[model samples]
Target: MYIDLAATPDFKRSLFNAIVAPRPIGWISTVSASGRVNLAPFSHFNLVSTAPPVVMFACNAPDDRHEKDTIVNVRETGQFVTNLVTWDLREPMNTSSFNAPYGVDEFELAGLEKAASVKVRPPRVAASPASMECELLQIIDIDPVGPGDTFSNVVLGRVVALHMDDRFVDAGGRFDVVRTRPLTRLGGNQYASTGELVELGRPNPPR
Candidate 1:
């Protein structure tokens, strides 16, 4: 079966997202300048750099009038928090993804406890396995691919502080990924869990 994207662009777009498989969920928390807190998830996110410790998340608006709360909040306040989602917090993480009004706080809506971030105004999810406090470095506007203008705002932030639960630390001095069971976005309404472990080492060139 072959499908040409030009003939069915929307379906192919969704199909490609599903094919990508197991993308990390950036459970982002942010605060409005007026102090309202918001939490949302972006599968289109990852650590872009490590030297200065930078992270990036993209917020896509449904339309021109509806800007994602996380994007607006980060732009308005210049701060955000990336809370790592785990199996225990899966339900709350999903709850926070609901499309509610801008002012509605997902923390309260999802019944999640909030912890103050050391370097950012946005609070972190207390139940999350780990969190990173970020200061907004820049926001890049992405050009649209289709018809009118499907815009997404990409935010690059510098991590100022990090929080990790000592419980996840093992005797080997490594964060235990198996125990955390982090949540991953699969595609449309689907999600995945951290399953088996596979270790691979870098290949060396012939001497």
Candidate 2:
């Protein structure tokens, strides 16, 4: 069936999310200027660059009038941590996504412990397999099309420091994705784990 995204009814709910299947969950942690810790998960997240190791996550406001706590904190402090969510940490990751009151510490709300970060003030999830400390590069705001629709803030950050569990690393220095089993997001209330892996090499062009 051919669908015109701009003309489709409830396009975001009907097709956008489902079509963008199996997105990586960036379990982001940040601290407010007043020292309150905030944690949330964003499915609209991915690495956008490699030379300086930049990653981006999109935070959608519930309405045009208000921004999410994570976005507010990131604007105030300019630092955040991206914690890799593994299979074992899925439940807590879900818990942290709740819309708690502003300034509430989600780490405590989720009953998870925090590990001190090296390059950023924001703490990383102690149970996560890997965490990347990042400094804010920029934030781009996407305005809504209609009057009641929500808007999104695209945040880009450069990785300043990385923390990884040595157990997940191979002798060849390759990080084992299959072993980590990261939690990924699918449509609706569905979720997936990276337990299976496929290997393919780049094809060479004929000279």
Instruction: Judge candidate 1 at residue 146 and give its lDDT.
Output: 66
Among the numbered candidates, top TM-score falls to 2
Find the 10 residues in a row with the least total lDDT in model 1: 4-13
State the TM-score for model 1: 0.92
Candidate 1 off by > 4 Å: 1-10
Q: All candidates' lDDT scores?
A: 0.88, 0.91
Query: Against the true structure, whose lDDT is highest?
Result: 2
Q: Each model's TM-score, in the order given?
A: 0.92, 0.94
Cα lDDT tens digits, model 1, 1-207, are 787655655554676578888889999999999988899988988999999999998867865355788888987999999999987788998899898887899999999999988877899999998999999999998877765447889999999998999999999889999989998888788888887789999989989
Query: Which runs in model 2 stand beyond 4 Å of their true positions?
Result: 9-14, 63-65
